[model samples]
Target: MHTRRSLLLTAAAGSSIALLGLATPNATALAATSDQGLVDEARITVQDFTGDTQFTDMRRKLARAKGVFIVPQLLKASFIIGGEGGSGVLLAKTQTGWSEPAIYTMGAGSIGLQIGGEASEVMLLLMSDKAVEAILRNEFKLGADASVAAGPVGAGIEAATTTNLGADILSYSKVKGLAAGISIEGAVISARHSRNAAYYGKQAHPRAILYENAVSNRGTLELRQALAAAEMP
Candidate 1:
């Protein structure tokens, strides 16, 4: 039984890796800028979301959002022990403007009988001060550390949804040109210090990068532009 189980697990892991390869064909191009690649991908993701008619409300919310965390490609794979993880960038809007992005990695696990892998884009909007505070900590779990809601979409639906939406964090996902609200209740989101340090040429904390010195990185100029373009009229 032990040997049989080991074989199954190995096969599952292999399948997961294969799926990622097919989804992320630009894997080699991913690290072209080292840490900056995530920033580029994030910009494209924001464009894709706000450009869609279904996300009209999502664009509206952006004007008032305190912060936004974008994971351009969240590669997810699963088997008996399901796990999903991806790296992302977070940018907070302030009186000055959108702050420079900080690196983060979110992951989750589930145990059961399952198979296969998939890829999607995820965006988390920080709606309130409390949500921002909760995320600044070392690590936190969605639906546990703070409240979360699937951001309502469409013009008419948005009005009703926002009125009833009381969650701190709003989640949205896009897959194969389809966009909708999603729940990431059990995922663990944490800071990625190594990525931060490597990109910034020093040890930079999330708090400082998000609030104080967002404009410090010249490479992020395009990212900032992407966010600005997503702004609605």
Candidate 2:
């Protein structure tokens, strides 16, 4: 059983590594620039989600969201052992407008009969102040630190929207042009302090970046614009 589990994990890691574009011999170099690339990808992800018809419910939720965390490419690999992980950016909706993004990472592992690999664009709409606050921490587990529910998509959007009001966070994801329910109940979201500092050229903390407005980067302007447009009626 132990050997089987190790094989499963190895397979899953290989898939994730490929999805991250780190499977090459030059992976070390690519890793150096991944922070900036992640931000750029995040901008594209927001634009894609807002413009896509399938994400109408997510856009609606974003109108009232206190914050948003966007994972441009969440990778999952499963074959008896399942693992999901990705790097993302988190931004707060402040009284002035959207704040600069702070880096975060999501990862989880589970045992199941699932088989296959998938990559998706994911977003977490922070529905309440509690949800936003919990995410600002150094690390937190989804469904344990804050209430979370899959955001309604397609046919059930209206009904689920009303019923999901009490959930602190609403998650939305898409893969290959179709909406997907990426199970993230036990995922850990932790701050990526080094990335945050590298991106901003200073020591930027999650709270300061999202809440205090302590730093700014011209590169992220497009991402903020996309979020603003998505929230419009």
Candidate 3:
């Protein structure tokens, strides 16, 4: 009777190990599935932002924008001495469309207590040939070297400014899903193309993805079409 009991215990342990081995692949697949969904959701968010009034205006003002870096929701923090924020996507426009997102970091060590916590959408219009060139090199700061300014807003073209710092710079803002008439200035933007590419498992830049003719899903396409209509001449 002891020998039979020992045999049964051994069989149960072996079965448990086999079951665990089978479950491993399913677990890995589930993780991959979740990540894919996240990427798709991010793309949808971009398309939604484009349709927003403020974002639409910014896009129209900078229609000729060669590169656009979009961070869906940028979290900002500030204290008495200094503050910092990191990990956003830098998307560059290509001949075809907008490129895949290149990860980026932005922060400044300054003195001030800008006590607030809000999710902001930052749009960088690369106006200088020098700025564009610098992005290709890697990641570079906006106000650190290049002149960044707040963009104007209105329905009429006359309301827009034609001033260019070797190229034109247009920026806009939105608060809690409402379009803010003011533009965001002083904030810096930089690209981390290498890290971004790694995240996407590609050797390409965000600009490449922007320009591609690939059709975003139904929701994205609809949003793009709406923004296009609003921005039409």
Candidate 4:
């Protein structure tokens, strides 16, 4: 058990470093980019997910989602021990529309023999206010801080929709441009306060950014519009 835990921790840290643009000592490219870049990617991701026929069930859930977390590119690579990490934004549904996005990071690791690499688009539908509240904290853990279930896909989607409704969050992912089942039960999500500050030009708590309407950006309008369109019946 200790060995497994160590592997997970190591993998998780590796992923964080990679996402922060430190994958290599002399690597010219930075994984973390401008806030506007992330927001743009998020808009595209939402459009891609909602427009896909494969995600018909996800659209159903989005219509009733209390909030949504969109991660445009979750890069998962492993030679033996595996890890995945990406940056994303969380938006809450408001009386007027979706709130401006708050910056966040998601990472997870696994202890197994695996040899592959993939970049996936992931979205987590916050089904309950409790789920949104937990995520508003400094850190939240899936399957610990909140109940999470994978959103249904493929032929069984219709039957599976009736299940997992009681969960606080429903997670969906697309790999290589097609829907795929993903297991992120042990993932850790942390607030990217520095990035948020950079994006909003001031430090603000996630609660304020997401709930209190303390900040707004003209840049995120398109992303908000895309999400609102998806939520519409």
Q: Tens-digit lDDT track for model 3 on 1-233?
A: 22432243345324434444343555434433333333343444455556665455565545566655544445556656545443344445455454444455665445676675555555566665555555554545555556666665545644456553344355555546665543234455565543433345444554453445322323234323332343323
Ranking by lDDT: 4, 2, 1, 3
Which tens-of-lDDT digit does each residue in 1-233 have in candidate 1?
22432343345334434444342434322322445656766777888888789888777777878888898767667877877777788888888778889888888877778688766789888888887777788897888988888887665774577553687888889766577444478888899765576567667789988887733668888888888778665
After superposition of all CA atoms, the RMSD between model 3 and the true structure is 13.7
lDDT of model number 1: 0.74
Model 3 earns a TM-score of 0.61
C-alpha lDDT values of all predictions: 0.74, 0.81, 0.48, 0.82
Compared with the true structure, model 1 gives a TM-score of 0.81
| Poorest stretch of ten by lDDT in candidate 3 | 214-223
Which residue runs does candidate 3 get wrong by more than 4 Å? 1-45, 54-56, 82-86, 155-157, 163-168, 181-190, 202-233
lDDT of candidate 2 over 135-222, digit per residue (tens): 8888989999999999988875786577787899999998865788988899999997855765676687899998787888888888
Off by over 4 Å in 2: 1-32
Which whole-number lDDT from 0 to 100 does residue 64 have in model 2? 91
TM-score for each model? 0.81, 0.84, 0.61, 0.85
Clashes of 4: 0
Weakest 10 consecutive residues of candidate 2 by summed lDDT? 1-10
Q: What C-alpha lDDT, on a 0 to 100 scale, does residue 72 get in candidate 2?
A: 79
Q: Choose 1 or 4, whichever is better by lDDT.
A: 4
Model 3: clashing residue pairs? 96-211, 97-210, 97-211, 98-209, 98-210, 98-211, 99-206, 99-209, 99-210, 100-209
